[model samples]
Target: MIRDALLFQLGYNATLVTLGAMLLGMAAGVGGTFLFLRKRALVSDAISHATLPGVGLAFMVMVAFGGDGRNLIGLLGGAAVSAALGLLGVAWLASRTRLAEDAAIGAVLSVFFGFGVVLLTMIQTMSAGQQAGLEGFLLGSTAGMLRSDAMIIAGAAALTLGLVLALRRPLTLAAFDPGFAASTGLNVARTDLAMMGLVLAVTVVGLKIVGLILIVALLIIPPVTARFWTERTDHVVVLSGVFGGGAAYLGAAFSAALPDLPTGPIIVLVGFAIFAVSLLLAPQRGVLSAVLRHRMFQRRVHLRQGLLALAQGQPIYEPLTLRLLRREGLALPDGVATPAGRARAGKALLDETRWQLVRQDPSFEAAAAHYDGLTPIETVLTVDQLDEIDQRLPQPHEVSRP
Candidate 1:
């Protein structure tokens, strides 16, 4: 077989890994889209790290029951137990302590992960060779995974995705406006519980690839990247699933290629890479788009500033510098208006900035004619300014300005 036949020769295993990863990614993308929007991104991190003890305990229980040490059922049991416990701990801390949600999540994460590490160490020392393979589960080794494990992952993903899809409307409303959802009798707490269940499933399925250390990234990043691509909830979910599925494949493939590399980090890196691209280049929310939009906005504002100055009869060569307007390409060479460019600029300003021309000079009849019988642009406000005002509103009333 050729050197790269690892991908080809292990076609069966490769298919399983790809399928499992796809399922896991799809589940994560669907649930995580809501989680990210809800600002509970770190909860996934908490659950992921806290699932360690669950895995260890599951393995120990399996041994007690005479099950195979490598059984996925036991592993899932452990992860689920620990995940529930972690959520409980997070909730208790938030309710009992002065610590907020983030603080509680961080606290539980550190404690649970620490306990897991200790338990892992104990298993390593006590079980010898039989337990040696268990260590791979801690960081995930996709190469060693069996077809059975992939089936379990895929099954869990399908169930989770189906449930979420079924309850999509309520979940979306609950995430965006809990009070509104509550007022509408949407069962906010039940919706939240369902979301947690989904998160739990995602954590368990993803355990084989990113393990505890990196699983949250898998859940959070793909949705975040996908968010940049669209503002519609359904579209976001679809795109997130696509990005997540592709990342899972690449992550698994890359790890399989470099035998020494852990699958979890590889998957995480793939997710992060996708997120970075979205953050930088996505049409509406990306860094490039934001920068371009801001530049365009600033230029419009500057042009309007120049017109306002000229409208006030400030000598263009005097108080206002010709070089500044020239640099902006807004002024004429002799400081008189470049009627065509200025009129074009004015029309653009009205459309772009929504500046209200309360009273138009009869001399500007040509431009004034454009707004006949229309409401003055003065009634409109910049989106940014609107956002600032919206921020002052109560939490429940904060409409999505998007």
Candidate 2:
């Protein structure tokens, strides 16, 4: 059962559909990274919604011409045209009007989608429309996907991926800093339009498998999830593609196994599950990891401060300070610095002094080195030197004062 559901059994139709969905996911993931980075994620939503009227209109036109209304190429071509128009409209609104990008996106999304609904209703009244299966474009119906339809999706995915790789550097620069990219003689606007074209292609290809309503989730969720695991743009893009492909594969397999299930929503749910897990558990940026890092930094700060107080012959047994000192092996039970503790305290104060001096004179490379964890801990300040340094150094509370 598992093997058959997973396409390992070589069921021709099942394998083709699964492959198509996976490729669509990968292309959306790669293209969506650019949109995500440019802070234009909602533009994808508008584009996807705007494609609906095109799909409905194409079907009606084909039927009126006495041709098969379900022609995949015709439907996809219409979707591409309308999606491009919608994207351009949003851009134009943002640039030419008082409306911000978000308001433009929202306005375009609702207007296009509402018009699509009107077109869909009109189509349903046509004599041949009942057999058109146009509603599948709204909610998705992967079970009806033909081998040729799958091929179209695969070709689009390959084209999108190729273009992204060929233009990676320019696109990266444009997304991060358009002014700098333009200053370097790159056509930032052209690069941005090319990216939107890729986004349109992905949205059109995805219409058959994931539907218009949910396709934006495929584009947005994977990239957002990938961000939790990396800081580098390149890594985030690669991981987003992997995550998107994984979700598509699993969703298709599960949907195949359960004949009543819909592929698009299932895929989105799986992607959301992955995002939730990453948001809470990823080591570098997850909520749990951030909390733990914050606690560790606080403890280190407290220990260093307590050690400095001990070196100054000041009391170290304040509840929080004393606990932190004991934890770091810097204070004996008698609330005094051990010999080793005294040595570490002297080093800490010296390190603090160098940090302060570096702050005052930013060109002090040697002082910067100590804070980088490159300086050996053998460096120490005598009690008198520490005392003199303390008199000039700003206290922790005073450092934050105006």
**In lDDT terms, which candidate is top?**
2
Clashes (backbone N, CA, C under 3 Å), per candidate, total: 3, 0
Which lDDT values do the candidates have, in the order given? 0.75, 0.83
Q: Write the per-residue lDDT of candidate 2 for residues 80-179, one digit (tens) a residue.
A: 8888889999999999999999999999999999999999887777654256678889877777678898888888887887888678898899999999
Q: List the residue pairs that clash in candidate 2.
A: none
TM-score of 1: 0.80
Worst 10 residues of 2 by lDDT: 372-381
Q: Can you write out model 1's per-residue Cα lDDT over 1-402, one digit (the tens) per residue?
A: 223433545477766776677778788888888888778888888888888888888777777787776688878788898889999899789878899999999899999989888887887887876644766766788877888888888888888888878878988898889999999988987888788878888888788866767777778888888888887988988888888877877777777667788988888788888888788899988899999988876654555556655554555544344555666566776766566546644555444333233223354344445552333343443466435434543464556877
Residue 148 C-alpha lDDT in model 1: 85
